[model samples]
Target chain A: MRNILILLSFMFILLSCSKEEKEDLPKDPIILPPYNPTYVDLNDRLPSYLPRMDIPADNKTTIEGIELGRALFYEPLLSGDGTQSCGSCHNQSYGFTDNGKKFSTGIDQVEGNRNSMQIINAGLRTSFFWDGRAATLEDQAFGPVTNPIEMHEKWPRAVAKINDISTYREMGYKAFGVVQLDSVLISKAIAQFERSIISGNSKYDRWKKGEYQMTPQEDYGRKLFNKDRDEIRDSLGNVIQVIPGADCFHCHGDLSDFTDNLFHNNGMDEIFTDPGREKVTGNAYDRGKFKVPTLRNIEHTAPYMHDGRFKTLDEVIDHYSDGLVHSATIDPLMKNVDIGGVRLSLSEKAALKAFLLTLSDPDFLDNPDYSEPPPL
Target chain B: MNMNTVSKITAILMLVTSLALTSCSKEEEMGCWPPLDVPGDSANVIMIFNATTNGQPLELLKNFKDPLGRTMQVELLKFYVSNVFVSFNGASTLLKKAALVILVDPNVTDTTKKHNEIALKIPYGNYDRITFSVGLDVVQNAGDPTKYPSAHPLSINQNTYWDAWGKYKFFMIEGKGDWDGDGTLTNIYGYHTGFDECYRSISFEKMLTLDATNSNETLNVNFEVNDVFFGKDTLDMKLHPSWHGDINTIETAFIISDNFQEGLRLN
Candidate 1:
């Protein structure tokens, strides 16, 4: 009996010590260092490097949400006819832009009023749409899906279709903790995927990061592009200070994206037919004015202007250089100044074009992450 | 069983007693404070804008008060006042909580149908002082349109203004007035406005005390439009000149700053 009691006590001590040891064990184990490249490998590359996306506190990004958004972006179920998707107009090969079309084709072969704006680096834009109708990318996503001529589907119907899909239903639940979906969640998901489509690995970015060097002509063009335009007064009567001389930055400022978020009547046309901004505002001074387009991937987003009138960069530069027409609502900066229009020399224009080309990131266009997903 | 065992047991008992005593004392200390619940009998004040002349409600377009106090027919009365601060029992607590502020247009079809109402949900408490601005602050007026739902409609109003257009209309008053040349067919504008520099701040602190039980109560504050043109600075409704913004005439500014406040009568 004594030996048996001693044996039992020994067994209890051993068991308790082992249990405590197990409880105290570290959770994570050290592993070998991950393979990192010293230089960016042109071949077999990873995803594009995106700048920090400014997400609202209300909307947070998740992998599952982005995945669901990607599916919705490519899925034709979002359209009434089940034929058109966001990817239809935003083809990846053409830098997520419908090539050189005067206007993008929507559902039932219906055409939109303006050309499809390129989605390259669209995440960096402060506002969306040529008229600056939508304030955020999420709001922009809500536009085409509900437009009668575009997707031709109500938000509820589109969300119902997404909810019907088992994969999306699961994804929705995982991301937002609810299988039921709404326009807010739908827009949030699409915005997440769009925010992930950042295009920062361009030649210009590489040069800026000291990874690559710009050619002499390209360097000259960069100087002219960044050249401060003459000081111009905004529609609000505040004097806008610009550097260099052309004051292009007055509308397109120096930032990650070049738009200043200001509406202007840039003297695009003499006639006041469209009355672009005046349609929104009953004010007489806003007639024929429109928001300025960003110049990040301006080389790819051709057929420029609110109406998509100009086809080539040369034509666009020429218009800015000489084709400025005067009007009652013309921007005061363009009034009575010989240099109101762009007056770049031939070499300067060529250099500018070269510099603009540097804005194009081959890595962004070829990013597999932004491409179609593998066969599900 | 042994001396050491007795000492160990006594020490353990004392430790347990000390822990219990400490916990009880801590609980007593925590329990000594009372919970803060704002009383519900706080007066719910609603400002009612009414057109009146000499303490009598004026008709829509007739019997309006002129600069000379003569009974003259007038058309429009619009002006903007900004930087409003409300005080509770003469104490400054207007900005303490997020107050629900709305612009209720009595002339709007739906608003008029709904008794010409805009409601802001304020915390339940005693407030003797109610202050508000006629115009928006520069930050509120110039914030990102997507941030605020109230500002969204005006920013994206297809028939009004675009999101990029950084101007907000505080008050728009339009009607036909007697012209210098011809007759009553002429359009006179009494656009009272506040934007940027034209922002005016109005504050009112009343000595009245309110007692609110556990139920909701309302205080109806009335504004006389005729009294807005009274005092040393008078507004000529027939001439209906533009005041505030770019066309800030001295008479308009004085009318906006002084006479408008004189018309406020809180009941």
Candidate 2:
């Protein structure tokens, strides 16, 4: 009986020590099992002329994150009625824009005034949206999800609904090394997928790489697009032939992405009904200003302008050529504002349009990777 | 406690301490300018720039009279300062590298007014003069912005690079005015100075001293914004409301670049 007591005491001590060890363990140790995701070097896929993307240090790009983000982008459960998704408004065929619609219709059947911007080369932009409202893509993702006229869903409910799905819970764990998903993680995933929608394989890019040659009209249009309104001169300082330049490069000159990523009031109207960038900056000087969008894939991403007023690119060229209206906050780059426009001749306008079409990349429109995934 | 138990607790505490220290290690600071080696007991030098128009603080979007009495309102002003060198009796010491591009924009908000100032550390001494350039050297001017970080001044994100022309705008002055004395400001003018021919080197001869007793010193530099439009030749706003990279206006770009040098004074 004495030996039995001693043996029981030793067993109790061992049990107590083991319990103490268990208590010492972390309360919420990160278990990343089945979460070994492959890191994606986004620069490897980007063009050589483009600069490195400013990816957040906390949210590095990964295959698992992109896949999860793609799913969430197409997930209708994110909306209030489970009838709308981000993919519904931002279709893949029309360069991620609403299909030839002036304004996008929301889940609530309400229409927004601003055109749905294309999602091409979004990773290269410093600011997002027509008014440059969102500073980062992650910040931009938070807007449409909760906007009353857009998705019309509350964040708490949306997060809860996403968390309720076991598939998303598993995907969230694999993508971000956590089982519990939040609005921040969801936005990050969507932004990652958006960053992957690159469009650098356009015909213009091919011509630049010497893989393809542009036609004479396209070549002439390229020269006109780049040339300023200033007159040409000879080496002897003699006045040479004056070329009617289109002057499009001043605002959209970053060839890698085809946008200077700056705001400008391009003299669209004398009095703005919607005060474009003023809402964001609260400055009178910025009243009519709006973000200068990239011209890549401009062929499919029409009608152009923030209002989507023009149905065809020809109307856009005509507006720039002969339809400018002077305003107080018009950009100084619009030097020909007095004449109402740049005044490009008919032939010049045709050539410019032909060159603009070279920016269209069929490969980007048909990429299966950007397509909606099968039901989870 | 028994010896075995005490040893186990000791190991646990050691592991916890190690993990805590590992997580608390300092992170390296990110930027274009890194801390450089300087002599012990170095003096602090601060370069202060005050932008003025007709001896008054220049305000953006406010109507002001030019030399020709034309009502003009300056909207934007930005310039580059590079290759800062301090000289003592013909011997020069480079205070900042050429690759270190410093952008000076007086239009910044009062909270960020320090953006117009530059700070440096040097050995205590009396410098006879200082020399700097208002533009980048040829090689640096045409550099690929993709090679630099986004935070760099020469990076594409800075919005100063003319990617279409493969060059940087050394100086930019954009504004609008009423050339015909109309109540409304109608004429828009922009002068972008760049290219190899437009680069200007400025020399300011002043007795600048940094002593051991007064380890901290400041040098004030003033730029008269009015001189940009009035100095040497009165810029005719009616004939040329804008100057771009066009071959006809290249001379105007050069003239504006020269005027930028004329506007500087050591105070």
- Pick by TM-score: which candidate is best? 2
**What's the DockQ for every one of the candidates?**
0.02, 0.34
Error of 1 at B235 (Å): 38
Instruction: Put down candidate 2 lDDT per residue, A1-376, tens digits, no spaces.
Output: 9976885585445335431222222224233355688899887888888777888888899998999999999999899888888998888999999988999988889999999999998889888999988989999987888999999998877877786777887788788866667788899999999988888899898987889999999999988898776644575645476558888887887645778888898989999998887888787888888889899899998888999998999999999889988999988888788887778989999999999999999999999999899998
**Consecutive 10-residue window with the lowest summed lDDT within model 1 chain A:** A37-46
Give the per-residue lDDT of model 1 (tens digit) for B1-267: 999999999999999999988755331233211111233434443444454556666443554434553444333343333333456646654321111122222112233222222233345555566676654567656633322332223322111221123455454343333334333223233443445554545556654344455333343446665455556466654343443233323345556556555666556
> For candidate 1, what is the interface RMSD?
13.4
On a 0 to 1 TM-score scale, where does candidate 2 land against the true structure?
Answer: 0.87
Return the DockQ of model 1. Answer: 0.02
Candidate 2 residue lDDT tens string, B198-224: 888999897777777888878787878
List the TM-score for candidate 1's chain B: 0.57
* Superposed model 2: Cα runs more than 4 Å off: A1-32, A231-241, B1-40, B98-113
